[model samples]
Structure formats: C-alpha cells, structure tokens
Target: MEVYLVRHTETVCEKGICYGQSDVPIAAPYLEIFESIKKQLPQDAIVYSSPLVRCSQLASYLSNTIIKDDRLMEMNFGNWEMKNWDAISPDEFTPWMNDFVNVSVPNGESFVELYNRVNDFLENDFQHNTSKAVVIVAHAGVIRSILCKISGLPLKDAFNNKVGFGAVIKIVL
Candidate 1:
C-alpha cells in the first residue's frame, strides 16, 4: 500500500501553545495550501483523517467522503492541552523534555503511546485495505509516528523527519 502521510496546515493558535488533540481550526486562507497539497496526491484514493477539525478540513478538500479515525489523532497533551509552553512550570516540563518518548504529560500520553495507536492503525486498518492509494490527514506527531514506524527511525530522532505543517510524506507499506 502507498501511504500519503499529510500534516495539517498551520493552526490558528499562536506559537508556543500546545494544542494537541484540541480540535483547533486551521489558519485562514487554507484553500491555496490545500490546493497545492491536492496537486501532489492521487485523484482516486481512500482518505483518512484525525477527528480533529484541522485534519478533517484538509481531508474534506481532498475527498468528498473521509474516514475519521481516533487512532490517527495527535498525541494527547493532558493538562497542557491549551497551555502556552512558556507558562508550563519548568520543573514539571523538564522531565518530559528530557524523556518525552516515555514520559507522559500530567494527564496526557507520551510518544510511546502515540506510536502504539498509530502502529495499530497501520497494522489493523490501513494494512487491511486494498485501495490503490491512501491519504491520511493528521497532525505532525501522528505523521511523524507513522514515518518512524515505516522508516525505522528512532523515536528520539523523530524531529529529523521535518514534518512541517501541510507537508506530505509518501511511503510504501
């Protein structure tokens, strides 16, 4: 299967805000970016998206019908859901920053947890599909997790994948 992992465009929230799984809206004037993204995708494919609006918005533009899967949602930030990075207590943030892969936020999950769900999605849902192509519209974390799973990238080096907003990564699975 050909998996097109697409990160949703920028969100309306300002920088420094941790809005994971918050259902935030994408930045305005998304049509241009959406169109550019569309051009690179196969016209005929089953589209999947995180239930969040940001991903759903882009998925809708790409296909009339889309499958919204909770497993594709971004990592949960728990108590830090909508808090600004700077506002978070350094004492509380230091441990997670040092070991984000295994450390879950106050009430949120860690990268390990995120990777589990994404891997499950791939193994159970995506792998079972016989479609010619698959487009998944999700967040940076979700996309990165998928990349790491398929490309054998270390969890610590996930940032090296360069999952910019609206970026699309194609991988064979």
Candidate 2:
C-alpha cells in the first residue's frame, strides 16, 4: 500500500501558540499550497482527513469522497490549547517537556496515548484497505505518529522526523 501523509498548511495562529486539536483555521493563501500538495499525490488515492478544519479543507480540495476520522486529529493539548508556550506554568510544562511520551497534559493526552490512537486507525481502518493508495490529510502530530509507526522510531524521538507544514511524504507499507 502507498500512503501519502500530508501535514496541513500553516494555521492562522501566531507562533508560540499551542493549538493542538483546536480546529484552528489555516493561514491565508493556502490554495496554491493545496494545489501543489495535490499534484504530488496519486490522483485515484482514497482520501482521509482529520475532522479539524485545517485538514478537512485540504482533503476536500484533493478529493470529493473524503472520510473524516477523529483518530487522525492532532494531539490533545487539553488546557494548553491556544495558550502561548511561555504562558504555561513551568511546573506543569517542565514535566511534560521532560517526559512527554509518558506524561499526560492536565486534561489532554500523552504522546503515547496519541500514538495508540494513530496505531488503532492504522490497524483497523487503514490495514484493511491495503490494495489502494491512501492520502491522509492531518496535523503534524498525526503525520509524525504515522511515520514513527511505519519506521519503528521510538515515540520519544518522534520530533526528529520534522514534519513541516503542507509537506507530503510517501511511504510504501
């Protein structure tokens, strides 16, 4: 199976803000980026997207028959959503920064929890459709989770993958 993992384009949020799973809008002038991303994917690929507007908009542009899945959503930042990184209390943030894979946010999930969600989607929804190419439009975290799963990278080292905004990565499974 050919999987095209695409991160949504930049969001309207300013830098330093954490908007995980917040349904933030994409930045302006995104049509051109979407077009470019579309061209890199298989034309007949099955399209899947996170329910967030950022991913949904790009997925809709790529294909009419889009399947929105909650599992594809970004990591849940809980109380940290929409807050500046510096604004979060260091006591709370430091622990997560030190061990994000195991430490769950105040009301959000841990990296390992997010990894499990992505794994469930791949095991239940994706693996069954291995005959056709798949285009997954999602957030950077979701894309990274998929990449980590396929590459067998440790969850703690997931950030090493460097999934840039609007980047499209193809992998054979």
Candidate 3:
C-alpha cells in the first residue's frame, strides 16, 4: 500500500499561535494551492481528511470521493489551543518538551496518544485495503506521527521535521 500524507493549506493563525485541534479555518486564497496539490493526487485514489475545518475545506474540493476521519486530527494542545506560543513561558513548555514521549499537555494529549490514534487508523486501513493509493489530508502533527511510527524516530525530533502546509509526502509499505 502507498500512503500520501498531505498537509492542509495555510491557516489564519499568526506565526506564534498554537492552534492544534482548534478547528481553525484555512487562510483565504488557498484555492490556487489546493489546485496545485489536487493535480498531484492519483485520479483514482481514495482521499481521507481530518475532521478539522482547515483540512475539511481543502478535502471538500475533492469531496466526491473522500472520507473524513477523526483519527487524522492533530494532537490536541489542550489549554494551549488558540494561544500564542510566546504567551506560554518556557517553564511550561520546556518540561513537556523534555519528556514529550509520555507527557500530556494540561487537558490535552501526549505524543504517544496521538501515535496510538494514528496507528489505529493505519493498521485498520492497511489490513483492509490492498493495491490502492491512499491520500490523507491532515495536520503537521498527524503526518509527523506517521513518520515517527514508520521511521522509528524519537518524539522530540518530530518538531525538527518540517511538514509545511500543502506539502505532500508519500510512504510505501
């Protein structure tokens, strides 16, 4: 099976905001980016998207044959949702970063938790499908989890990887 991990288009958040799982909408004029990405997809491929509006809006462009799955949603930042990163002091974020593999944000999920959810989806999909290309339109964190699972990378290094908006990454298994 081949998996195409596609990040959603740019969002309205300013550079420092932590908008994970906030259901924020994509920025305006994303149609051109969406069009360019749409051209890269397999014509007969099955598309899946996170339930978030940013992902949903882009996925809707190819709604005729796409499925929305909550499993693909980004990791919840809990109380940090919608807050500027600068507002959260290093004291708060540093500890979590130091032990992020198992630590959860206040009222939010840990990286391990996100891994389980994404793994469940991948396991189920791989078991039930064969010989077809699959495209998942989701967030940066979700894509990072998939890469971590496949590449056996440490959770801390997830941030080091860049999953730009509208970027496409293909994984084969």
**Any residue pairs clashing in model 1, and if so which?**
none
Compose the digit string of candidate 1's lDDT tens values, residues 1-173. Answer: 78788999999999999999898898998899999999999998899999999999899999998999999999999999999999999987999999999999998999999999998988887745566798999988988887887789999888888899999888887
Error of 3 at 36 (Å): 0.5
Give residue 26's lDDT in candidate 1 (0 to 100): 88
lDDT (Cα, tens digit) per residue for candidate 3, span 76-118: 8999999998788787799887888689988998998998999
- How many pairs of residues collide in each model? 0, 0, 0
Q: List runs of model 3 lying over 4 Å from the truth.
A: 125-128
In candidate 2, position 57 carries an lDDT of 94
Could you say which candidate leads in TM-score?
2
Prediction 2 TM-score vs. true: 0.97
- What lDDT does the true structure give each of the candidates? 0.91, 0.92, 0.86
Candidate 2 lDDT: 0.92
Model 1: lowest-lDDT 10 consecutive positions: 123-132
Give the true-structure RMSD of model 3: 1.6
Q: TM-score for each prediction?
A: 0.96, 0.97, 0.93
The local lDDT score (0 to 100) that residue 98 gets in candidate 1 is 99
Q: What digit string (tens of lDDT, one per residue) describes model 2 on residues 4-82?
A: 9999999999999999989899999989998999889988889999999999999999999999999999999999999
